[model samples]
Target: MARIPTAELSRYLLSGQINRQGCLRLRRTPFLPRRPPCHNIRPLSTTTPPTSPAVVVVPLRKQLKDQAKALKSSGSSPRKKKKNSDNQTVPGWELTVGIEIHAQLNTSRKLFSPALVPESSLEEKPNTHVSPFDLAIPGSQPLFQPDTLIPAVRAALALNCEIEPVSYFDRKHYFHWDQPAGYQITQFYHPFARHGKIVLYSRDGIAAEDGDRIEVGIQQVQMEQDTAKTLAQPGGVNWLDFNRVGVPLIEIITRPEIHHPATAAALVRKVQMLLGAVDACTSGLEAGGLRADVNVSVRRPGEDKKLGQRTEIKNLSSFKAVEDAIIAERDRQIAVLEAGGTVAGETRGWSLGGTETRRLRGKEGEVDYRYMPDPDLGAVVIGKDLVEFLGRSMGVLPDEEVEGLMGRYGLTAKDAMALMLLDEGGRVEYFYEVLGELEGRLGGEGKGEGSYALLAANWCLHELGKLTEGEDAEPRTGLVTEFVAAGDLAAILYHLHRRKITAKTAKALLWGVFNCEVAPGGVTDAIERGGLWFQELSEEEYAMLADKVVEGEEGVLAEFLRFKQGKSKGYPQGKLMFLVGKMMKMGPEQNLDPASVKRVLGERIEGVYLPQLEGEEK
Candidate 1:
């Protein structure tokens, strides 16, 4: 007989026959009560149940081809329809959501073992900062630095979590090309901090509203080690960055209670604030060291339909990406189910280039996260005193900063909030200092809130806002703060509040600060030293003559009569103050005050508003 080829023979072996009568006909599938058969294929084991938790393995070549052929014959098999997550469909399907946020702890050294460098000084290079522990060589051991725990704990407390008196670590085994260390040291099941929370606000700045005030619950925040990153190149070979290996990571989780994508976005933003509040990490999204892996599922409204298998969107890395991925995934699933198909459980990646999410298949129930206590590192025992200390010292909370602007100063809620929120680091504090000085110097008993400081807030926040973003952004974050400090702000405010300089001229003065030969001076100097003066000088002088006027057409003394009425003719109180500002520039130092111009103006006006001498109160 002709020699049977391996491919042909293999087919015969499965079919139990070899024939070529045009096309060999194979027997139809046989069914047995003992086997839970599916898709025209018999189970590999005789007594397997359809709902059993055991892995489903079909006979390699035969099962795959048969399923494909059957599907093709029917055009396509019907897929299971997906329900809404909140179970808030038209029937009000509720969408139950929980999230897992993986933020790399900001540390001078890596986790598991010291490896990562101060990302500040060095450019990110593959394996450049790798230590022996990162390499996973034989005889390699692990270590944990105490400093890493502080920042991580601080951030958790800022998230409003209560630190557990005792929380520990475990090793989770999962094999990946990049993780040649065989297993990863992780904290699973139980984390260091539990029941933490994240808060979100309304777009309108209203704390309470329909789509605002989202609060997501915390499952637990765990500390773990990060795996090295792989950068895939065009070729099959991948470039590796081991420098990040063993980096300490904090895993923050949430309850599956959030119903909307907007809520997910809000939760991430809250975490950013929490990080900043603790001063543990920069609240920047574009940079690494912060990443959130979002867990999502869908269900139809009112169905109580079991949560659709959750699909994890991995490495979202940014708040914007988190929002975008949730939306994209929601829409993608809706489209599939609307077309009558089921969504398989899997992991996904957010494509920065495409702004989309792509699926990653799940082959097993779990990676078996083969968890065991970390051998190299010991348990962390948190003390009550240390927790208290960190909480007090934890950095600024955005909301509290806003409140400070309102209560401590005379700013309107809007302006004060804008100032602090616009610039957090050192800038808001500096503004508050200058505003305080202005208040002390002005000597107004500061009655009636929401009028003056609010105005200052508007000016300060507006200027700082212009500096940070938009196409017309500033090159310096502190540049405005510095200018505000040198008392130039004082001079400008003096003029503005005194009504001496028009509001329009006040802005012009600031613009001048941005690009003049002055290299950015304070508000006061900008007015004093600048050759550009917004007011007309002689007109001011002409008004001053009222103090000198003979009260009878002492036209020659008309100038003095005008002066008797304080500064000039037809000038607003603000204009007179600008004249005084001029005086200060022209007069000796320490003999000057902006408000004094006001007092002097009011007194002279009273002196000149005198009896006509022709005898008339008229």
Candidate 2:
């Protein structure tokens, strides 16, 4: 017999053959050494031998290849599935999301140390705010701060969470350069609050339709310490700033009830508003004061009880990032399941501009953390009376303020939400101050009921918001509140309300007040000094002015006629406004109300100009 090569013999061994005993067995060449049997590799069939003497066992790899070949022969490719659109969820799949928000408490001192918290973390020099306890000095003991508990409890109450009478801290053991201590102390076994709910509305600056309401549940609110700020250098070196170390943080964990990305962002915004309302956490994401970690998962629509494996996108800094990351992660998991792959539970990080998340590390279980009660800290206990007192002392929350604005002033839901969410607490105050002045000055004489309040809100939110919006798009309501006093703004709005000044003149007067060109509470004096009063022309005088503008600008009149006859591409209303603008410019010293001018000019174009042009053409 010819000797078989080693490779040929191994191939034959993988493809078993029938022996003389009528059993499948590996065939070895005579020149090759005998190999030990693999007891783990069982036969595919253990039945009695068939009538045929030959038997062959196909390997798993060969079976897969044969199936792939069959698919190719059938003119189908394994990689040709339909792709999903960006905004559409995968068909037959449902997404579930939860967020963990870490908001730095507005406290002057550290949680367990006496280090003074920096007022501005970015402006303060590094290493200057660190305390001996914050650096993990051997003998320093953890002291609980009572003042920090006030804001924490207030936040819990604002979220409608049930306050825990007693809570304890546990040490989560981890090794990292940012944490000088070997373990982090946090509320693990018992959080301070639980079972809260945040009601999100469509008008809450989210992506829901009108009248849509979603209630997201709060799992728990636990107090924890913030880690040090880690700044990485260009050359693999790292700098640790301990200013943030031991800073008080409240980790707000929400239940996996959210189904949409925009809802998750709205929940975060509601929390920010509530916290700011209660004077708890004034710092926002830009200042490293608030951070959100989103957990996203997807499963088939019928699998209500069973959730797919979730991956957490950590440390999202903005509300938009929170929304986009959840969306990207949801799409990613859906694609994995569709492509016949499993989604592993892992931690992920999102790049600022990237569309997908990158794996940070494998998900750590409770055993990995090696959690134990902190020996240095004792249980925290709160009395029922203190909770009641803090609840009573809490300021008007976002929801209450929104409701009040809508009920009292008849403001729309969108307008009410906008007022509450602007510049923390200052925008609302300025609005009320302006309303008060308007109420005193106008006394509901020229406007409808609650119209003064409406006027005040619109000017504060629209005009002032636009004027104060600098390069970064954040409204400098503080600067507006500082320079443009409520009385000054109210004075200008008062003149506009009484028809003494046109809207254009009112806006110019506001700009003067905002830029400090007008003296405080001297809007009347400025209007008098500049003779900025509305020129109230009678109907006859207005028609004369309108005719003067139309006859002088024959080209504009022809265009207006063309537009009116549907032969032009421009807006007839715009052309009419152009005529009104020309007429207004003719009397620059007298502030003309554009509304009156437009009305008069529109009548001339329709009642007089169009008939003349049509008759001339005929």
Candidate 3:
């Protein structure tokens, strides 16, 4: 349970204070109790909380024991697993994975070239957005886009990366049709930021060491230019679309900290969410705005000292694909090793259906890139003022937004996370707007018995989730034409909450509005136009319907008589309900209250039907 001090350690790492042996000298902090100086801290950052006092030196033994006890009491510590009845240990394989995410920066032009990288929806023809510089024509010079730093620095800060004061570009040379320049201008030697970490949790926000959480280390965040798309045409022709050429991108590289494929997938999703939260990238997987290159390796337990040869699965499109590709590659590697075969280092592409990966090419060494300084661009300096300005522009991220939603609207953590994750573009904003309107109508400030935040959240996530079933992680543009407005949704909830209509009626109204079967209108007006208002039968009407149901079902009546005489074996209540439902369905215009129906069915069955059955039995 020994924990490394991540905050202080990262500060040292960024400040170049760590020794050659990777040891940190802790400086004592004032106003905190002093502890004995100690060693034996691993590089892992999971053992200690980031909010721990900023004091440096502490005894490793005491810290470990204390943290262990704390974690044990909280049920968040690693525990020994008992063997199953088969007398075998849990399936164990030390799976190591690192992921590199390429996010397309939201900018008007390319990173180093002024050429436009057209948006995905633009109608521009192929190669229209390219400039001579992007085409690498002779005498064309490169210039850096200063606007790219806003998103890059924002992403760095959001990911807990330390922004470097000075960063420069280098040429990474490789031969490919997509890169007309024969080299990509990238931050190979000194990236914009380094030494960042992202703590990922389970779908429900579980902590690390709980087996469902992970702490992934970010190696660096670098700015680079993207290549154009190469397409294959019929008859052995090749086509290049330069619309995407020289587009700005940020490559986020992580250390090999992932231990499972699912965890890796979750880490990728968490990164995507963070990027989208900061407006650093659109992260549209289907639109090709973001992608992950997962590096996977495996070794047996207790062989931590030996690093296995790894394979890089390049450009898995979606989060699910990331998971599947890693798992497939890991299994493939483990199989090869178990069969007394050597795993080769190579680059592979995800298969057509994402079931497996195909070999792309042998992995190249660093020398192959032929790295050199880019003479066209000078050192990019990020001053303190620029850093502060970019930092302020980073709005609330998912973590903070989750807490804020929970605290403000009295929602559970799961509920909050659901809302944030399924936000489908502006759907989250629409949800909050509806919640506000509902609060106003309820005559409460989200307090007391009338607070409908929970109800609203359930309706939105469940009902709206069904509507936008397969929306990508990125927000979708524009509202679906059939969907109801926030004000209308609020009105629907108000009537349902106030007992003005049954839950069934409210659902019907919502479905109608959502499908455009009923035009947009006030909740009451829509209800009336659709004839969906809850209907309460009069005493006489209820009696008549109950009598008619019994009279119409002669076979069911006989069964009821036998059951009353203790001759038949089934419950009469179910039979009565079936009859009632049949009658209710006969009139679609009438929105009957189910509770009232149940009441009438029970009364008729007990008072009128029971006596008649007893008389018949006699």
Could you arrange the candidates by lDDT from highest to lowest?
A: 2, 3, 1
Q: What ranges in model 3 sit over 4 Å off?
A: 1-92, 204-212, 352-354, 406-415, 423-425, 444-451, 465-483, 511-523, 529-531, 537-591, 595-618
- Sorted on TM-score, highest at the top, how do the candidates line up? 2, 3, 1
Q: Candidate 2: lDDT of 75?
A: 84
> Best candidate per TM-score, number?
2
**In model 2, what are the clashing residue pairs, if there are any?**
none
Model 1, 1-618: lDDT tens per residue?
445455564344222245654445334556623433222221122233466453343433445468657766888744533332332232333445578877767677887666655474224544567666776754568877788878888988877787898877887888775675788777786577988776655631322322546666788888887776664433343445566678777888888877666567667766765675566764344456577778777777665457776788877755556666776687677666668998778888876523357877662343466677887777888888988898887766777776676676655655654454343335566666656765765676444444556656666667645644458655663446664342555556656776556566666666565545344345555566754344433434534533432234334234444555576655355544544555556543233334554455455544554334324423
Q: What is every candidate's alpha-carbon RMSD to the true fold? A: 16.8, 19.1, 19.8
Minimum summed lDDT over a 10-residue window in model 2 is located at 39-48
TM-score per prediction, in order, is 0.65, 0.78, 0.72
After the best TM-score superposition of candidate 1, give how far the Cα of residue 447 lies from its true spot, in angstroms.
7.2
**Candidate 2, after superposition: displacement of residue 151 in Å?**
0.6
TM-score of 3: 0.72
